[model samples]
Target: MSELNVVSISAAKLPAGPFIARHLIDGDWRQSADGASFERVSPSHGSVVTLAARGGLRDVDAALFAARQAFDKGRWSRTSGKERATYLLKIADLIDRERDRIALMETLESGKPISQAKAEIEGAADLWRYAASLARTMHGESHNSLGEDILGLVLKEPAGVVAIITPWNFPFLIVSQKLPFALAAGCTAVVKPSEMTPATTVILGELLVEAGIPAGVVNIVLGYGDPVGAAMTADKRVEMVTFTGSTAVGKAIVKAASGTLKKVSLELGGKNPQVIFPDADMTSAVDAVVFGVYFNAGECCNSSSRIIVHEDIAEEFVARTVDLSRKVPFGDPLDPSTQVGAIITPEHQAKIHTHVRNAANSGASVRLGGGPLDVPGLNGQFYQPTVVCDVRSDMPIARDEVFGPVLSVLTFRTLEEAVDLVNGTDYGLSAGVWSENVHTCLEFARRARAGTVWTNTWMDGFAELPFGGMRESGQGRELGRYGLEEFLEAKTVTMRIGRTRTPWVA
Candidate 1:
């Protein structure tokens, strides 16, 4: 085994017992109606990290009813821009104050590095602040040129109650992406964090309460998808459902919401690619490849798991990536120095390994780490930073989302071929090009079938730029003015001044 493949597990403090968590419904902390609950085991430490209320149909019903009542009462939805902005800003400040506490719980539940968890928590606060800015600046439109004495008004109104279903990988950040924007748009919401990682979101609910948000504006229910998420999607009281998870589950949510014809916004899976040209900055490109694939243990939907490189430079680039992959620390998440932490579950770790084993069997070369890494003093699941070369376009590892610390290397001879390869997957979440040539970068950016295209960059995001996917990746955008618009409904009003409207009766 390469020395860089595994890192020595250092001693770290563990929580004495699982933290007790509860649901936030109608601005009150509550337990499951049946007193049922579930435990979330730390993927890095193999110990129970959280014991949370397992919501049932009754809990989901109550939460949805609360959200609908809140929206109908117009406590939040009818508030002025300034009033809403005030609440959002206060929530942002609370998030900053509780950052460390939230980050620690998030790191425990999500199995990501402590450093990454802290950064995500801090980044989530920025998202809330940005949403506050949007709340204050949201507006409608007026058309005075419609006709003489006739005024046309375009009004933006809240979309009523929304169901926000977030995944385990990015509990805090994803909720911040959806909820604050929904709130900024004056919409009430019922949020469902994944059962595996529900602690931080519950913490966010605590912050919302501390920020003095009105009751029923935001509610949270914790449990599995069957009861909690299904109830949220199928509830007629909810006007919209915004979800971030796998494409398969996204399809299910869409189908369920279709019964009520509820508006839906989904941020689903990705097999994102980063294409490199021989004329590109090789050093920068190699480093990005390593960072992109290994970041968050490749569990992120935007992970650049595959790279289509120029045939001429493929050999050297793959070798450099392999070398860097070995150097990334992999061990317990609590160890702040560990760059890549444990897998979310043993099954997921096994699935990641299956993908690699199958790819190797199909003739792809496992150039470096390709199996599980045993971390000392940690009994949790962890996969090695893996690199596979000789990847064919038709291979499963090249097309499917093997979300792990694994990189698949594909080679191309022409820009057209590179673009084709980038667009080959069923996912169109994100794609990138690394080249010094402006023409190549511009052409690729235009031709790539992705929601966000990064030229000479990978996974750099902002609150200003809208993010989502095209095709099966997802529908509807998130983050930006567009994100707020997703939770709004537009209405047109026509008024006649001075009784200048003509009567049609003859």
Candidate 2:
């Protein structure tokens, strides 16, 4: 047996060490009232890296109470957009300053390659900066509908205290995606990060405090979704709930927030499709499909898991894709040369393995890498870049969100069939189309059900563009001005001027 690579981490610096990191209720890290703690599993090696306190309903109450106090005080909300933008912009700068440390920690905790982690880290910092820039341009509507003297002015205000629940995949990036915008909109928030990956969020809480995000303005509570998430979602004091996770959980969020009719935004799971046509540059198409599906170890929700190739080019594309899939190097997340890292955990690894096995048993032909990988000198949670052909659209592996390095290739006889197959799912988060034809490009881009449609590209995202889904994929939106609006509510200030004008009513 060979020795597995081990990395040590501590909380003294920017990169966090394993600890009983607790809730930031009223801007302080305090242990949970119940004293319950959960193991912080490092997906890189499928081991407990550290212990973190699990929050109960009481912690939720405390966090929400602090948020309410901050919101009611109207300090953040009353601040001009220009002033709020400064704080957000400062946070952006701090993220860049500590980018390397945060990226390293992210790679270790999330089992993502160093390169990918760095890219995500950079992207998140850009989001804060982007949100800051967007905040300045926010304007109100001035309509003189009633009369010239009676101007019907409409203003956008912060949605009060917000409950932001993020997923485990891109913890810091997703949190940055929401928080800067919420702060830009002048809202205080209680952030509940996924228990599996709470380190980055905890580290970010410290950074937020340093950036002068006032106490109660930004808080993090680590816990399971049930009591912590349930309490926040159902609380009447919370004006908005922004969540990113599975569709099943998004439904629960909707149900929980229904009582208070709070504003909500969800960015959920995806089985996004990539349609490859005969006209596409086969070399680029093959490379894009391989990277699209296997990048980040196939953990991204925006990943194009379904490769819908035209019958004319299906075999060739699959052959080239299979050839390239084998080239993706999988190993330690810290290795700079490594391309793919481990699957998130043992349970997720087994889930992916089971889906692959089920698909193979059900008659789908497995072409390349279909099982867990054993890298030399590394006992990490790794999986080979899998490619499956002869897959029917109805197969479980084809329809479900395995969230691992598994790709399914299906043939489409026509453009209509390609579109149909791409949209034939409960998800509509994103899709990709590769073709040289202008008409075909425009057609699919227009009709694809996903919130994001990329032509001749895959998984290229920016903060200026909205990322979300249709159907059960999610509700509301994120990024861009639409994302900023998600944290705001519009109120029409209608005043009665020249009352004598409506003498008949009097």
Candidate 3:
């Protein structure tokens, strides 16, 4: 086994106390109706990070009412594209200006590396900028060729009162992905970020108000999924629901929304894979495998947790991957050099460990560290960089979304077998193939079941490209033109040029 990559523990000064986070309703910051609040302990520093509002059904009702009013009044929904673009641009500038403050809170609240949080904030700004451009470029279709006397038109209009429920992981970035697109399409929203990571989203609400978004245009409610998310999804006033979280929760949201039959968009979990051919660049493939599994502590929905390597080179590749995984910096998130941070919570940490333990007990080889690590100065949960090889295709760890820094290795002899291994799980979020031959790469790309396929890379994302998954991974896309369309409904307008239609009653 290689030495654990225990980098310097962060000695950064702790905050004076928990940051007070409140709900944003109708352009005003307010507390919960019941005066209930929750405390979030930093998963890295083991200190109280945020004291956030605990919204209930009543809060959800108020937010929904505000969003419904905003949409119906049409102050924002009926605004011209250029006008909407102006608001988004202002928000983007504010995001850039407040990146450090948001990043610091996100790191403390979400247990992500501060550097990564900062980058996500930067990327989120770019997403807003992209959505701004989309706002300006939005258009409708005109069909003058229908007839000389008659013309048909297809107009795109907003799907009002969107309910956005984002998960704890990537809280700020994921909300940025959904909210800006909805706003660009002239939709009002009620947002419920995960209770664990609500501070950054609240900070975003401040930015939104500072950018001069109208009252009730984007109301935010912070609390648990039961009363908060549930109420948001089931409310009759909400026309659409866009969520990013666990597959089980996503299914429940779908069932809840079925009562109203509102439009639903989900970006759920993944056990993504990276297939490595023998002829691929060994160094690059190995590096990517390490980065993919360990990035964001493998809490991400798109984490490349599994790797399918050709039998001819499986041994060498797995060895290289294990070695590289050992070098990934794992320690305090405040330390800029740490690449992997603490697990979000002790419960999640236990879940990650259970998966690895069950796999090892079921005859898999634990190549590297397979349990929790002890950080010198932190009292929070820290998982070791683990690599599991000799994994059977049917093993739980091989197929389940282990959602930790645990890498599973599966071997395949042929391209067919590789593709099968990649598609074996219920997830089809993202997959990658490493190959030197163009033909091999193209064929694998064609055969992969995932929504996003990378030829020689993994998890390289852009605001211009559409992203989501198939099967149990998710439904609907999150970025680009499709993202804007997710919040829009098409209306057909047919007019007779001279009112020359025959009267059917006559």
Cα error, residue 385 of model 1, in Å, equals: 0.5
Taken over the whole model, the C-alpha lDDT of each candidate is 0.92, 0.84, 0.92
Q: What would the TM-scores of all predictions be?
A: 0.99, 0.95, 0.99
lDDT digits (tens) for residues 416-472 of candidate 2 = 999999989889999999999989999999999989999998888888898899998
Clashing pairs in 3: none
| Residue 307 displacement in candidate 1 (angstroms) | 0.5
Q: Weakest 10 consecutive residues, lDDT, candidate 1?
A: 1-10
Model 2 Cα RMSD, 1 decimal: 3.3
For candidate 2, the 10 contiguous residues with the lowest summed lDDT are 1-10
RMSD after CA superposition, every candidate: 0.9, 3.3, 1.0
Full-model lDDT, candidate 1: 0.92
Backbone collisions counted per model: 0, 0, 0
**Cα error, candidate 3, residue 458 (Å):** 0.8
